[model samples]
Target: MGNTDKFEMIANIYDTPERIQIAKVSSDAIRECLVDAKSKNAIDFGCGTGLVGMNLLNDFKSILFLDTSQNMINQIKQKISSSNIQNAATLCFDFEKDSLSDLHADYIFMAQVLLHINDVELVLSRLYEVLKESGHLLIVDFDKNEKIVSDMVHNGFDQIELTEIMTKIGYRDIQSKTFYTGSKIFMGHDASLFILDSQK
Candidate 1:
């Protein structure tokens, strides 16, 4: 199955109580990452079901929620509309190929989605192009030190590898932290959060 198909399948199962708890943990980490940012213009890349966007409402004045799956975007739209989150916009577009249309954001967030991309470096480059000077890019995904499961399609890199890639792409002050100490059977690994700011 393709990425979108796999995502769609998961979306059906993601609404369970346990999954909602995990999503809350992820969203909390994302909220902590944006606490220091002064800019209000932000983009939540791969914003599945609007979890990240919902948590980010206080930090950012406006948010553009971009995701590859139309289903995912629809889910986010539903949540936003029902909750009256007026400062957000949902876009169904592939992050790799879509043009940013002269938009420069102060912060770009990609949580739990970087590993699924085929080319990490290229994705970083694309994100960098649309980021304003000294903009921060917060990436939260599975750390390589964590064990892999059979169902997971894409594998993640270690902190060193991720930091190297960010540095090579002209990002500075790269910092990483592991959020969850314990692991569950289904998740297969403890998740990590990486925070990096673009160099001026």
Candidate 2:
């Protein structure tokens, strides 16, 4: 299956109520990162169903939601429409291959999206290019660990390795927070939230 097909296959399962709840928790964490920021323009990379955007709506003057999957963008559109979130735009684009010059934003968020990307450094470099100097990039994804072997198959990253990569790319004040998710019904994974400031 193609990359889009792989994501589409799990879109339905991810949109379920249970998964949405988990998304909300993740979104909350994202919001916390931007709580003190002064940026008004924001972009949600790989924005799925608008969960992260919804949480960050009030923090930014405008939010551009970009994703590789049309299905995912549709889901996000539905949520935005239902909530009447006016300051938002949805774009279909792949971060790995697409140029981000057309959509510059002060802050960029990629929740649970980086783990699925094969070239994390390339993605980070692109983000750095599109962001304004001193801009912030917040990434929330599953951290590398033995406890989440199954999840690692699809989405995973080594915290130390990723941190080194980000630092090499000129990111500063990089911090990662490790957390656990899931209860009895589902298997929880070790997730990490990374916040970095782009240096000029």
Candidate 3:
């Protein structure tokens, strides 16, 4: 099965303790980069079961939980319904293939999502078009690691290389740092994660 199929199959059980902890840390990192965010609208791009977006509901006026898996979107919808979360919405979308021309946001953030994307630059450019002027795009993903090899996903990303791509895409104020390290995080090997902040 493809990666999207895998995510669909696991959506109902995706929020394991380890994943939740990682999401918490990722959200914390995203929070630190936020500035005057409460009044802004945001998109939790590639949000998986709303794990990261759930913790950030109060940080933005509204958060659109976007993912390619319908099941994952359904999982987040259930959470929104249960908690009466008025500020959260969900969208099942594949930016790589589809065009969402009318949709836009003040901020866009994704956690561990880029690694799954086949065309990183294309998706980033699509997101750039979707972001409002002066909007921010925050990314949380594992740093490059040679220990983990995968055909389905990128092993990880190089911050400098990623920054260069963002710069070429016209993003400014790009900054990134390794914020967290954990065992058995990327694949089965220990890995470090970085948080990157860039402006459109």
- How do all models score by TM-score? 0.85, 0.83, 0.98
Q: Model 1, range 17-126, lDDT digits (tens) per residue?
A: 65566567776776776655544788988877767667777788889988888888888888888888888898888857666667788888876777678768888888
TM-score, candidate 3, is: 0.98
List where candidate 3 sits over 4 angstroms from the true fold: none
lDDT of 1 at 76: 82
lDDT of each: 0.72, 0.71, 0.93
Worst 10 residues of 1 by lDDT: 191-200
User: Candidate 1 or 2, higher TM-score?
Assistant: 1
Which pairs in model 2 have colliding backbones?
none
Backbone clash total for model 2 is 0
Q: lDDT by residue for model 2 over 1-200, one digit each (tens)?
A: 12666776665555677656767777777777674454478898888666767777887888999888888888888888988888889998887877768667778887777766767788888888888877788877765545554533444567777789989988888877665444532246434434333342
Question: Evaluated with lDDT, which candidate comes out highest?
Answer: 3
Question: Which window of 10 residues has the lowest lDDT sum in candidate 3?
Answer: 1-10
